[model samples]
Target chain A: MSGVRVLVGTRKGAFVLASDGKRERWDVTGPHFGGWEIFHLKASPADPNRVYASQGTSWFGQLIQRSDDGGKTWEPVGNKFVYDGVPGTHLWYDGTPHPWEFARVWHLEPSPTDPDTVYAGVEDAALFRTTDGGQTWHELPGLRTHESASSWAPGAGGMCLHTILQDPSRSERLFVAISSAGTFRTDDAGKSWRPVNRGLRSEQIPNPTAEVGHCVHRIAMHPSRPGVLFMQKHWDVMRSDDAGESWQEVSGNLPSDFGFPIDVHAHEPDTIYVVPIKSDSEHYPPEGKLRLYRSRTGGHEWEALTNGLPQRDCYVNVLRDAMAVDALDPCGVYFGTTGGQVYASADGGDRWTPIVRDLPAVLSVEVQALP
Target chain B: MIRVVLPAHLRKLAHVDGEVTLDVEGLVTQRSLLDALEARYPMLRGTIRDHVSQQRRPFVRFFACEQDVSHDAPDAPLPAAVATGDEPFLVVGAMAGG
Candidate 1:
């Protein structure tokens, strides 16, 4: 009997929720590194037992923690993330050039085939790769040094490379999304990169449909259809069938397309999920109702999954990295809210239940389907 | 042996139950003492100070013998009480941010 391990990173610490294959009952452990801010925790695809966590605080700076025996034990690993050369400058919020600074790691994406290889997306909007587990990280500076680098400005939440998606069919190609820098895809591993924001439009920027200035909140892809991608942008939901070459508005009939996280189901290539929030300025749910919308036709058409979710007076916001899915039989969908609730829907998106009601305000959630 | 008191979070990270003790190798200046401390507990690096700059972090402060030594030059010698191990050096995480 296999099991599932859900690794949750929160504003204060990290937690692990484990359950049998049935996905009925769960066992919770943690508050690991109790007073620290765990930005993200992800397990390696090659080996389910290997996990990498990004822990930090405004007082203590950043530290990377690695777990070898699932979440049972952990050890501090290399946290040094030095840029390759002189990290110059990117555009400030006020349109002035500001020097690039190393902040915190926003996302940890372990390699699909190698446990030792992982990618770290960080604030100041940059990408780094570590081939020695979490021991060392070296930036693939091409993304940061792009021709339009000088004009890249920080979004409201600071310029952060918060989303990383790998093409399961092609090991050499990778995709990363920044807070305000739109999306970039690297075809030759991490050496070279290109911006793929053709159809993205942001009303906030002076130019609504620029090449690289759109604030993309999150992007998700199903393994079965690597070329097809879905995005929850700052204002609209989008879909791309040409591997991000161009995107089309898929916000369709949803109440309000403004959302943080977007995800695709494990087995259903055309099925996807997004929690619709009120607006960009107001991060809470619309009408104070927390609803999870599922689109069966990939995009444009959606149905609200409100069976077990809060329908009235629920103002909690789900962050961009707080939603993930496990590869169980019915395909388990999991998401954590800013109100410190982790909800699960074992049967697609019909019904839901809380794994743990109150924890630190959840930051990121990742799931590992055990063999 | 010189006594050092770390902040609550640093203590948990360095795995020190109480005030830690360190043997300074050379002239007991602020820089030398911290070098010894980091050498003994490598995990404390980049927490109290930066990895490349080697400067005390903005929110981190240093005190010795009831004197604030955070703004003092790194190479300046510490007070005799701290050098003699009678008074412990203190590293504090400033109470800042929300």
Candidate 2:
């Protein structure tokens, strides 16, 4: 009952880490999706037995694979996000698009209220909401075919929706971040949307537009208090006290303003974690030092937590979906790097330890504390 | 033009080892440089650009100076320095996911 299962996704495949829960010794498993890059992996909070993975091959395209019995045997879901000849019609293409046109699923969030309900953000600048698990999906037309979509540009990964924050309290209320397209929030489900880019910077336009392109990398919300949110922006890390209406840069004491991912504690409303990278220069942690900054008062003040991290010049980059927190008593925090290393802190971000290192370029990480 | 630093994976596929220098003729579009790169490396032909459409591969990325050149047109000419041999054309295996 105390073992915490850590799932590490990589460019090559996915690995499962089983820990002893104390002085934790993690056991690694699989290249799971078999060479296809696993962009996102999640273990359902409602049922830890159910695991979902988003994978794509350079030559094969994208597919969603689910594992019902942990990481043992896997099966591809019947419904796919394939694009056929029809423009407006939502079809699941088998990855035969032009070589440059590759649709990758970046993030997957199983609805907090319903395990059967799921949402995924794709690289083609669209969001797919699936009910009855991954069996079928309907493109959230509001975010997918929005009017301002024509003006929204992709970041390094191509124009796509990266983060979708579903309100834990009111499932209908949601927040979505479109890379280079700014952020959007929907009060009445996905029927309509509005721009929440106030106080954010967008270099693509001479003056920042009201609706999009602030290069938002990741967004996280306080599970209990849905309105309070935190974002790791391309230029700044911010906090939205009033349900993302406005934001203020809270990276006052952080190492770097530019970072890819930020996470709030699953249980603590004020506690948050961020992997700070040198924002203005080439994306890497400051001085090659991997420091996880934690804020006790909702990013107002920060402290560097580096107990078991590398004490040398370690220049590795952590992507948007890499760092995440597991549902545990102390709340386990984990992150993987471009250098093929995975670091976990069972006691939140206070003390850090490497679960696995020097494997392959890690793409994403998900931890599920076993029930 | 923009100098691209090739990652080890692409360098090995292209053979010749290290960062192979190339002078791209005309515009330095992703397709043009990849075409030039494939022509010289031979082994790297389908590695960077698709064998059929000759488009850039999904996993392979083109970066010069500090910007991503993957989305750029294949026919568009690259920067003058890159075309002249001032900087190395980087063929990178984009690090994604985690």
Whose DockQ is greatest here? 1
What's the CA error at residue A97 for candidate 1, in Å? 0.8
Full-model lDDT for every candidate? 0.92, 0.75
Q: List the residue pairs that clash in candidate 1.
A: none
Native contacts retained, all candidates in order: 0.54, 0.08
lDDT of 2 by residue, B1-98 (tens): 33445666445333446666665566676666666666775545445655455767677777666667778777777666677667666777767756
Encode model 2's per-residue lDDT on A127-230: one tens digit a residue: 78788778776677676556666556566767668898888788678899977777898888887888887878656455764556578988898778888889
At residue B2, give the lDDT of candidate 1: 91
Model 1, residue A3: distance off in Å is 1.1
lDDT for A316 in candidate 2 is: 91
Best by lDDT: 1
